[model samples]
Target chain A: MTAINPVEILLVEDNPQDVELTLRAFKKANLTNYIHVARDGAEALEFIFCEGPHAGRKIQNGPKVILLDLKLPKVDGLEVLQRIKRDPRTQMIPVVVLTSSKEQRDVVESYKLGTNSYIVKPVKFEQFIEAVQQLGLYWTLLNNPPTGGG
Target chain B: MGIDFTNNVTAGGHQVADQLAASFKEISDLRAALDEHAIVAITDPQGRITYVNDKFCAISKYSRTELLGQDHRIINSGHHPKEFIRDLWTTIARGKVWKGVIKNRAKDGTFYWVDTTIVPFLNDQGKPRQYIAIRADITARKMAEEALRQSEARLQTIVESLDEGLVVADLRGQLLHFNHAALEMHGYSSLAECRRHFQELPDTFELHAMDGTVWPVGQWPLARILRGEKLHDLEVRIRRINEAGWERVFSYGGMLVNDATGMPMMAIVTISDITERVRAAAEIRHLNTALEQRVIERTAQLEMANKELEAFSYSVSHDLRSPLRAVDGFSQAVLEDYGDQLPEEGRRYLQSIRAGAQRMGALIDDLLAFSRLSRQALERQVVNADALVRAALEELAPLQQGRRIEWRIDKLPACQCDPMLLRQVWVNLLSNALKYTRKRDPAVIEIGCQTNSGSRVFWVRDNGTGFDMQYAPKLFGVFQRLHRAEDYEGTGVGLAIVQRVIHRHGGRVWTEAQVDRGATFYFTLEEGITL
Candidate 1:
């Protein structure tokens, strides 16, 4: 197999405890490459579009997948998802909606906006880690995505 | 001696002749005086006038020349009946004198009334030869007698036809007159039966006094009048003898009419029967009492039915939620714990199971809300629509945060409505707009209001995948979802709850949509409520 560039994952989450759990889950899965974090919807949008504070970053080397939280401050997760999907540069990137809300409307709406998958962050810490591990393994290793070199 | 005797006889005969002549003159003067003192006329027995004296001619208004040859028929006024004239002729022809008041006509056709006597002059064999009639003008005395007869007849007719039983008794209680009605009322056959003193009347009974004690006839109406008392309308009960039994009669008594001097001459009493009228009045009172009792009973029954309905609604709201929670919680547990262990097909089936339970839970919640709305009392307050929309959008922020949506809020008017119920209406409608608009690249949500007369209607519009208009009715029904579970996830009770909340505030909710274009939901906070 030809050598591939290391996979980059972007996690947009507001809660500190949830972020810690997500990092622990990635470590447990043994699939760490390059992992980036954005505390709010605004930070995630800047990182994807390379605008505002993230203007110095190279735009061509964006994250392969975005994990978005529906509830966030400054800018909301749905707006970040819409900005990423609307721009041609970030349109092909896979999006996974990660939320604490189990509301049916949230799940249906996430998928309807072209989210690759939707997962509710469980209240129990162990179940949440397990769900993250499975999602990471499936999307990073098994799924084939179009690679457009920047 | 023969010559001397012859001369003496001749002298005596002459002297006797002279004495006879003096006696004849004295008799002729007496006959003339008799003719002036009496009105006399002589007619044949066939009533033909033969001779009339000067006095008879003067009273008849005729001269002797007219009266001497005319029959009595010439002065007949025709006032007397044929039988009256015939009787006069019969009595005179039998040589008896007949006396009567007769009417005759004068020569100038004026009338005269006369008291007349006709005497037949008879021959030696007692056969009538002529009639001698004596008359006196009596017109003034006859008029007085005729008027007296008419007044007496009128009084007699009134006494017989009176409706009241009238009794007139003397001061000693001796009955003077009893009318026909009075005799009938007292059960007596005639006035003669009551003619005895009231005390002696066989059928008379004692009247009750004011103290309710019996009073004898001597102390009754006649007795009061005799004691110089003027009694009027004294009510008394009289006992009457009837074939069935003795009947009690109500009577009124008063002093009888007397001369202007005010002497106690007689007492009068009148009576009537009132037994049937009194009994009928008592029966009507009894029926009225029974009708009042039935009306009270029916009113109590209606009150009881209203109370029972109130209790039933209370149970519907509080008792149905417990089981619904259990179904949803257990299904969620099964999916979370065993989802990975199950195959893909098995996982999908479990997911469907979880969805169904969740849907059922939502339905139960909606049902409880509907029941609660019926029991909730209205709480009215002023609601600023713009502020209310901001609050509801804040609550729904978690759902729309990650979506690309454009919110265009317009100026809205203040409304009079229940604040809490109005909030529920905004939550349901705005959340539905957010959910359905998720498919769009940049979801556009428009929040605005319009004024219709006195009411303000608020709306939330979305550019999303809308449904067929045919299924619009089912949008607010419990568990009635338009999209399949795989395409869209929903419990479908959100819209239904919204509709119920708006309706409770007397408002209305409606949607307009075209397939795959967009959906707009319009609602008012002041439903049937008027300003």
Candidate 2:
């Protein structure tokens, strides 16, 4: 396989500790070089649409796999996910939901909104890192993203 | 000269003799007059009866012989006070006349009353000579006067004590007579305060009937009397001073007084206070109106709650089932599509997921059944407990096939209960007995009833894996199971549904159990009655 672009693995997480652990796990799994981070849903949407501070960036060069968190300030994760799925430019991109809420309604709704995978973020740090590493390996190396660029 | 003297003497002597004869005849006639006019009781100054006429003797019921020498004490009736008798004697002895009415006893003990006047005849020096009394029978007159006084007193008392005001007014509206009540009714301290004439009374007073129709004074009792109109029970309302405020009075009147010529001369009005009675009747009407409004409000609230519960049940049935179908169907799809490639653990996990989903579906169905029961209207009938139990046992027989079980059915009485609901109760109870006793070699289930006092109590007793009595309170709670799901296979809603049905029939259910011994459930179709 050809080397993936550096911005292909984008993580939108509010917790700094979660972001650090996710990056460390991805490094151990040999997938950290392509990883990027957005602290909130607004920053993630800006990066994807290439607007505001990233105005000059090409939208078609967005992340190949986006790990989205459902809870965030200003704009919620679900609305961002809905906007991404609705727009054709980001509709084909694989977006996985990582949340602490195990509520049945939330899980069903996430999948119905075209989320590629839904995972409950484990409470223990070690278990959380393992979940992140496994998700990175599956989406990056095993599962194939769309060949058609936006 | 001798011859002239002889003639004069002879004429004078002859005239003197004739004057003496005339005087004798006048004396005899005066004596007869005295006997006819007076009851002559010629007593000495000591009141001794020296002479009595035939009339006196007859009135005294004594002969002259019996009275002649007796003092006046012989005829004393003892009716006079001591001072009265003393005064009478003092006056008569002093040559004075004494007049009095005396009650005296006759010789035969009969009593008679007389008006007597006694005169003391005296000599020229004014010394007492003899006493003479003249008396007449006065019993009839005294009796007549007494009867008249008693009748007047009774009439006065009746007028004073009457609750209604009574007024008598002449045809010209001049007030002739009025009762104490009438004075009070007119807000006056006395009859004089009201007015001697009816027209002088204040016209500021308004008179109306109970329904507020105005009544003219010209149509009042006195006016009716003047017009010769006879009025009876004509209700009129009057304002009267009561305590510090004015009160409303209900009245009726008619003409009662008649003139000397027997014509209607005056009118009488009767009245009473009816304010309290009127107010109480109004209050009752208000309460009844409020009660009706409350009933309407309660009925509306009940309807709203019923609609909400119905909507909730529908959502539970539709919304819950949609997702449940997805869970079961997708798990089935995974097994079918990739069974050959999947590991044994993966197949097992998928099967467990399907099992859990199916169990959830069963729970939802049970919940729906429970909800449906609350809205079902009761159909009442006479249910024979023995027959209902037998039918329920038969229905559960397919699950109890080849099991060694002992059944004891006591004589059960018929009761007034809902048949379908009662049957459901029996099905839940007997099935529970069969299920709990499944581990036993010989399951002993006793279906029986006992007559307790005036009520019949039916019970289902089972020798089974009984639960701790400490957990008895939770036995009928929905989804509250004492044993683990692995130990007992149940939805845990059977007892709850049984309780609901029994309660709707106005009955109660209870249980007694000891761990690993047996359990007995007692129920009654009538509240507060236990066997």
Which 10 consecutive positions of candidate 1 chain B have the poorest summed lDDT? B1-10
Q: What Cα-based lDDT does every candidate model obtain?
A: 0.71, 0.75
Show where candidate 2 strays beyond 4 Å: A1-150, B1-113, B116-131, B136-159, B162-182, B192-204, B218-236, B240-247, B251-270, B527-531
Q: Each prediction's interface RMSD?
A: 11.3, 13.8
Candidates' chain B TM-scores in the order shown: 0.47, 0.72
Residue-level lDDT tens digits of model 2 in A1-150: 554353666788876655655565555445434667888989989989989987877788767778888777677788889989999999988777876534444567888998877665422334433544655644454344543343
Instruction: Return the top candidate by TM-score.
Output: 2
What CAPRI-style quality would you assign to candidate 2? incorrect
Tens digit of per-residue lDDT, candidate 2, span B122-181: 868898877878787776886787788999999999998998778777667887766888
Candidate 2, B518: how far from true, in Å?
Answer: 2.0
Where does candidate 1 chain A have its weakest 10-residue lDDT segment?
A122-131
For model 2, how many clashes? 0
